[model samples]
Target: MEKKIRFVNGEQVQTIGVFAGSETLRGYRRDVATITTTGIDYAQAVALFTDGAKWSIVEVGEEQKEKVYDWSSHGVAGPITDNRDGTLIIKMGKNNTVEQDLQDKVDTARQETAQAQAVTEALAGQGVATVEAAQAMRMMIENAAALLPDSEAAAVPSLSKSWVVGEAVKPGDRRYYAPTGRLYKVREGQGHTTQADWTPDKTPAMWVVIDIAHAGTQDDPIPAAKGMEYEYGKYYSDPDDGKTYLCKRIGEADGGKIVLHYLPHDLIGQYFEEA
Candidate 1:
């Protein structure tokens, strides 16, 4: 007789054959179903026989089940495939969050790099080679007249006073004396209150005459003097040479005053022609 055995939690199966009335079989020979344990907790065994068959029990140990992943809960709408070894392969679509974040970072970096390159090129066009050179140029342009004297003191306004008695004066101070119709600068280190009969023209030691006539003008330029502040773009007459010069640059002197550096006569042709 043929018999079949079924078990729950079972994986592999084997088959055996038995003969009746054999000398090796003793007593009542009946077909019996036996199973080998494989360390799994199985349910009760059941056997089905065609005529005379018996049943047998098999005990096995328990095992842990594999974990399954829920892709939808993690905002993953991609197609996933299992490699059957606790790993997965996923194909990300166009709207993937991770890819979009990385692309945004790359775009920001490119924009910053382009801006820096533009600044470098602009500075190079102005003959500035490095960032430090550019910064120094900016500082000089901003504070070009910082070392010069105050504008109020340097400027000879239209209405000015003449040297009078008991009038206070300091170094670099200028006063228009009505008698001579000329401007005079207080001599260096000569700071004191004026006294009677101490007029500017009479006391050459206390005051230095700046101009014989009036303030500088385009047509009648005044001679540039020491301890005098010359303004940019103004016209002045050079003392050494009688040629009228445009104040191209103002430089700092020993006592924090501005000195004038005129353009050379040869270079004047390059900047201005006969016209």
Candidate 2:
């Protein structure tokens, strides 16, 4: 069984459904309404949540009707199908692990369904033009985007072990290990990559060592020669394997606008600070 953290001092947000746009954009307005309230500072936030601990866990809803495009070939050449039932419950709170985060996947799916319904509803309305319909779709996409966290989410608290819950950063995922001062490689995405989720020791000490499975410049050919140290906000892909990874100069990815979905990896290392 995987481990998860339940926060001692955080708040949860009850949501409201507010959909913008007439005709086409009239679909799920409530999805955009879910809000969050957090009590922990940045480091603790990052240590516990994927969105730098924004704590927003989207529980997906039921399946709503979907318009068929050439690409929407029943889960073929289209966007990912997270949840289709049509109910969405998004929960943002201080969390413990990516697996823990998965517990709320249903909520996010619900949000998508609701928003999708809103779009279809708007499109079905009278006098809805193509542009208006497009706008409604954009609104739904925007709702998803709004879930992101802010900038300060990456900041590490000085002289303390900030509890952070992160997504699965594996041993093989493209990452930069600061402790080793060498970037390693994970050729296949998660398929070939073997990694354990990140967890800081409950008992703390002095300095922390963060180990990263990294990706270096493909142009360099050799990894050690091309292996480099990360300062902050540097994105790179492995040359031999064509895998991508990024170093959080600030030390993490927050639910904030700081998105590294483009970056994948499960990084683990240690440090000693406090108990």
Query: Who wins the lDDT comparison?
Result: 1
Off by over 4 Å in 1: 1-161, 164-174, 178-180, 184-190, 193-220, 239-241, 250-275
lDDT of 1 by residue, 27-77 (tens): 222222122222122221112211222222222324533222211212212
Q: List the residue pairs that clash in candidate 1.
A: 39-61
**On residues 173-224, what C-alpha lDDT tens digit does candidate 2 reach at each position?**
3232333343233223332212234322211111122223332233322121
Instruction: State candidate 1's TM-score.
Output: 0.23
Q: Each model's RMSD to truth, in Å?
A: 38.6, 24.7
Error of 2 at 164 (Å): 42
Query: What's the CA error at residue 58 for candidate 1, in Å?
Result: 99
How big is the positional error of residue 12 in model 1, measured in Å on the Cα after superposition?
Answer: 99
Error of 2 at 149 (Å): 39
